[model samples]
Target: MRPDFAASSNPDSITDSSTWEAELNLGFTQRGDKTVLVRREHRGPLTVQRPFYPEGEVCHVYLLHPPGGVVAGDHLTIVATVENDAQALITTPAAGKFYRSGGGEAQQTVNLKVAENASLEWLPQETIVYEGAQLNSSMNIDLAEHGRFIGWEILALGRPAAGEGFDSGAATLNWRISRIGRLVYMERLRLDAEAFQARWGLFGHSACGTLFVYPASSLHLAAVQELIGDEANRGVTLIEGLLICRGLDSRADLLKGFFERVWGLVRGDIVGKEVCAPRIWAT
Candidate 1:
């Protein structure tokens, strides 16, 4: 007689039923020459309220991922608002990891808005994609007149340790930046494991990342070009004061280190040291 497979259910199967969801909002306001803000929301499954204060001119925010992370059909949203003349920096406590989707898809959306003459630095930790996971992410930024903004995204396709490198699954990323309801920068990246892994495609290196700055001046453009020269075979584009840097590498740590170096250069030149780094990164 054949074994009755339906009679036995594994413990792992029972635990996979629970899904994860996280909704967070961070608000910043200017106080004299300093920017003060409070993080009022929950982190993943943990229901705790945390507040952050700026050490100098910069304020930091940190995000912690749930224990198991997003399952199929999970949705996560993050919204940030910077008041007039305020400056703030946002970062995640650690890199976000997306596990394989059991049956459905997972999505994440980020929205950022800056008031007139305000500045915002979006420096998320990083994102790692696991095998068989489907992820869709979008970033939208609205800038006020004379507002300064800088941000970066570093994505690793798969677990290099296990020799898994985006061999399957799908990912789509979109970015849009606007000024006073007028579009300034728009870009979209779509990739499939097999298609993108080809020699000439995106995943040939296993990891890719982008760094962008808005309202680039002539001097800034020259300086950025000089800084990126022969660093990693990067490409720089300028559109209406926006400077964009696109880079690809075979290692995840290399991409992260590159962002740190480039961010330091750009921040020192454009935003100065008075601004605070994201708090999550400090820990």
Candidate 2:
């Protein structure tokens, strides 16, 4: 299991009576050509549904947050490990909500580790940030030689369709990926409500998203490009063998659909088999 997140700069953050800190750790292993969940530990409201095998060899798990949403000073951490030759795909049943903060920030940290010849897919639903909310989110991925990973993140600044925009809030995001003990990708995004609404910045867009694929080989670059044609408010790039796809939109549904298509394509190629959406996604 991964270590807990470092203590917050404000020592009182977790000590507040209203604050809630949750943690969950999971490990997967291969059992005679079938991926199975071998370990799981949790504290607080984080948990996972029973493992399902939709593709025979791949295990599908759905992470659950029973509280359904996060409030001020809430801290959530998740860590997952996949052993050699095992494959696992994890997703959420619904969008994660970050409610308005009362001068305190909510934090979420995730770490994933994959051993040699292993494959892992981290595909959670979108995250919704309410006005006046302060959110800090980070993801760290470590992969051994020949390991593979695919993941995506979507964030909505506010409820745009409902006429609620991010008039006041702060958002910080960090993503890091390392392969065989060498860092290959790192990105950080910080947004202040005022500047984020500027034309030169987010341009009043209420939602932004990114899809990341690691270890994409030259042989698949052309195919990847063909799948992602030129589109407004969207771009695709390859950095240090990581394929990054980014987009900005007013609605989360648009970005969600876009990411799903790319996920299907990439998974098919990497796994050498067609994949279907997990049954839980429809519920």
Candidate 3:
């Protein structure tokens, strides 16, 4: 039987709490030729679905938030560990929503560890920051020798299609990537409504996205160049062993699709497995 979300079956059970603190820890290991999710634990609204082996050897999991969104005073933390030679892919079923905060800030932190010869793909959907929402998000990845990671983060500020704009509130992002206990990539970003207006900042774009990959070899870099195609809003760069891609667009969905195309191409070349959209992504 497939494992499902562990949070309260009733989504409303978490909304009444003055402050929400949730944590999920997952561990994956390889058994013979197939990777499996061997450990899963949760403390609050955070949970994960059963592992799916669409690629035969790669384990796929969907992270879940029963409350459907993060409000003020909500803190969520996720920690995932992949054992040696194990391969895992993690994603979300839907876009994460950061609701308007009356006065407090919502926080989320993700920590991923990949053992030697292991691979991890972090491909959560876009994050929507509603008007007046204050949010802080951080992600840290630690890799051992020969470990690999590919992931992306997309943020949409305000609901432009609905006539709402990010007139107020603040959002901060921190990301750190390391291998063998040494830092390879790190970034810090602070975006407020006022900063969003500057041409040098988000470039007046309501939505921005970034994709990062580790162990980017010459062949992988060439593959990325071929994938660039006619994407004028996107740029790719290689730093150390990491390949960084960034894009800005008024439509978050369109931007995500563009990135997805690139992901398919590069992922196939580097991981030796063609990109297969998660079943949940289509639903």
Clashing pairs in model 3, backbone N/Cα/C closer than 3 A: none
State in Å the error of residue 126, model 1.
1.3
The better-scoring model by TM-score among 1 and 2 is 2
For each candidate, what TM-score against the reference? 0.86, 0.91, 0.91
Q: What is candidate 3's lDDT per residue for 176-211, written digit by digit as tens?
A: 999999999899998898777788777668889999
Q: What is the lDDT of residue 22 in candidate 3?
A: 96
User: lDDT by residue for model 1 over 1-283, one digit each (tens)?
Assistant: 2122123232113222556567777788988867877445545543223436656667665555545355557678888889888878777777776667665678888999988878888887778777667889999999998788889998877777777767677778899999988998888887777655776667477678888886677777777678778776466777888878778887767877776766766676556664355555657
Name the 10 consecutive residues with the lowest summed lDDT in model 1: 3-12
Which residue pairs does candidate 2 place in steric collision?
Answer: none
Which candidate do you rate higher for TM-score, 2 or 3? Answer: 3
Alpha carbon deviation, residue 139, candidate 3 (Å):
0.3
lDDT of model number 3: 0.85
lDDT of 3 at 17: 39
For all candidates in order, the CA lDDT equals 0.72, 0.83, 0.85
How accurate locally is residue 247 in candidate 3, as Cα lDDT from 0 to 100? 89
